[model samples]
Target: RHYGIVYDNLVAAMRAELPKTVRFVAGRVSAVEAGPERQRVSIIGQPDVTARLLVLATGMGDILRRDVGIERRFVHQRQSLTFGFNVRPAGASAFKHPALTYYGERVSDGIDYLNFFPAGGVTRANLFVFREHTDPWVKALRDRPRETLIETLPGLLKTFGDFEVIDRVSSWLTDITVAENCKRDGVVLIGDAYQTSCPAAGTGVSRLLTDVERLCMVHVPQWMASPGMAAAKIAAFYDDPMKQAMDERGLELANFRRSLTIDTDLRWRARRQVHFSRRRILHEIDKFSPSFAARLRGLKRPQVEAVT
Candidate 1:
């Protein structure tokens, strides 16, 4: 199945299977008023509810975190537009065989990465184009999404040839950071609300799921056992397990970002040489043993994989 389809289906399934015992209140959580025995949660919708413990499931709301004195590191940039295309039979032939093709320097500023994956025993293919995060030219045309996409299409066509436009999507602005810690007393943040990393490293989604699973399965259960035990357990969970995961993933993302940036002429030459060297090695490896790459990736898997 396509990754996008799989992701959508998984989300839909989760939303469909609501617990009968657990009442889900859909609204914005404005405030959390703590009391002696329970906590009062202020909801923007009609009536509010009170609970023994409150779980703030807000995702990536930096404004609220800042109001509570939690300092974030990443900067939120403007949103970007994504364009997709259907591969024409003739155009698909160019990418029938597995190959890496460089689209060109992005109209935004830096170079954009384009990749094509062929469908097995078919004339259909999938193409992905990574745009620059913050490009001056792209930002200038942000208000005109269609014009922005039209302007960008030429750069893609110049490298990949003819194809039919399938769908155009727009993503919200997000922040990226390397800081690991995202927890505090009486309140915990999950998903983008806490910390964020570069998407290129593929850590954001996995890390967010890890946070949710860990909180719900381990920390929440212990907290529910007794109010006296809640504080210590929360502290331990955030300090040990959560902190370690974030630290490791954050370091990996930081290293990757550092490797991509060029400060000097010598550094630029070194980066280009390294990039070519890695490409050549990968090409040779794929030619000899196709499954070796998969095995290498599997070796890096965590001991426990969390369910999202």
Candidate 2:
């Protein structure tokens, strides 16, 4: 019911499907000049190029964004850490489970969860944690990933069967940010350029896709049918109802994940208990009365509303 694919492979597949008329210039962008009717781009070792509009997808790169006078407001600094690596059964040829979500066993660990899923013919492990990037434990995990994982997650070996990390560990530190002063003539920001999401929140791609759909299908045609691409024209896309709701939901989910994992308040402590208890109950119910469990799952539960 769930699936995973390599990010680069997905991009390559999409690139291959693009129309022949679409051109991709390979060079570092050095400067940008945006205006009411035209946008100019200057790339290193390349001739200047101009277009009617610019859709920037430069993820977290601030040079061009700053060149155009856009600023970033950090919602949360060093919000979370994500680690990725390939894994395979140690002595056996297969694993006990196809996919697994292992929740952190201790609060002091600051680990949110470890996910194991099949992608690109290999079992990939993605670990999400709420911890300082400079922490000694983080260094230890990178230096001796297999040992550190087994020692920290003792049940992982038993739950998923013995496995060995087969590749270099890759780590990323995420900061939740949103662009400011982005409503400008001849330019628009989408995905991480407009806003960054917590990887644990699982909303980055959704937000990006939503932006593309609304901009391309809803706003672009309307804007092109008229005259100059002014700031007023760009503001409509930023103020789109669906896009605003999705962006707000991303922030809400990002905060909820952090609080659920690390907050030691009385309310969260009780909520945490209820959360795990419900999951355990559901697992047990499904094992015996799957049809009844399906009905219970079909019942709408309360949404995770944002708190001030």
Candidate 3:
């Protein structure tokens, strides 16, 4: 929840609007049991709660999926690793811009990209690596984050300028996955509880949001009007065209980002060269004439900078 997302604040603000009938029981869920008539949820150190329908919005690591006959099949294990830290301009050098992005130079380097931006009163750096967690590089990062990163990415310091990692380097290893055998009675899994997204693809939140909108807004209301909480009704949500498309798109984008990052095929190699070359050209043009750069952007040619 503390992954620099605004969800905590949003929920905190919504606390005041909670109706008297809606009692918020805050505790960890230990077990879940679901049936056609009623669903029972067991919380640690608390009495069980029964509901007509059970919604599992827990992200990524919920064990309740198995209880509802949902399966998580990993499409790719150890897909990517991400590092989050704060950076500031070294000494009095002073950053000229509020944000900047630096792309990885080599596939062998195992670096995907690095994003440096201002958030929560600090310049936050999100770095994506396409290497195994057990790799020596990963170990080096854990032990000496700044030096290891600079070593792996030679041009990083020169491009982003010498900056210190002013906080603990938070890291995450992601597994690309999708839930199977999930269409069940009375229980529905949403967000990362249903499908896992590659952080490097930046589609995790998008997929989760699509899940929320479809399950909550589109399907649930219609189901409530009907008779039984059968698997058939639950399957309709998964069969929804929009939800299917978004899930497919998330998988597609995940593959695209991975290929773009480390695929050394001739075609991809050329595209990568052209991709950065075009940005360099535009950057030079921007330096020469800000107005001209803004005007040129009206052409709608995409200027993509990987934000990790």
Best by TM-score: 2
Error of 3 at 204 (Å): 1.1
| Per-candidate RMSD, Å | 6.3, 2.4, 3.5
Return the candidate ranking by lDDT, descending: 2, 3, 1
On the 0 to 100 scale, the lDDT of residue 278 in model 2 is 76
Clashes of each: 1, 0, 0
* Quality of model 1 by C-alpha lDDT: 0.50
Stretches off by above 4 angstroms in model 2 are: 289-295, 305-308
lDDT of the candidates, in the order given: 0.50, 0.90, 0.80
lDDT string for model 3 (1-308, tens) is 12443446656866878889997899999889987778899999999999878989888885878877788898989888999888788865667556776788778786778877766667788888888798888888878888987887887776667788788889998898889988888988877788888888887777777887887788989988977788888889889899888788777777777877889999988877887787788779999898897686566543233332
lDDT of 3 at 303: 29
> Could you tell me how far off, in angstroms, the CA of residue 273 lies in candidate 1 after the best superposition?
3.1
Q: What's the candidate order when arranged by decreasing TM-score? A: 2, 3, 1
Could you give me the TM-score of model 3 versus the true structure? 0.87
Candidate 3 has which clashing residue pairs, if any? none
Q: What is the C-alpha lDDT profile of model 1 across 188-307, one tens digit per residue?
A: 666656655444344666777777778777777877776633344546556656656764665455344334432235775576567556556766887778799546534543322211
Candidate 2 residue-wise lDDT, 130-243, digit = tens: 999999999999999999988998888989999888999999999999999999999999999999988988889989999999999999999999989999999999999999
What ranges in model 1 sit over 4 Å off? 6-9, 34-37, 66-69, 73-109, 112-135, 140-161, 164-173, 177-184, 228-233, 261-272, 292-308
lDDT score, residue 104, model 2?
A: 90
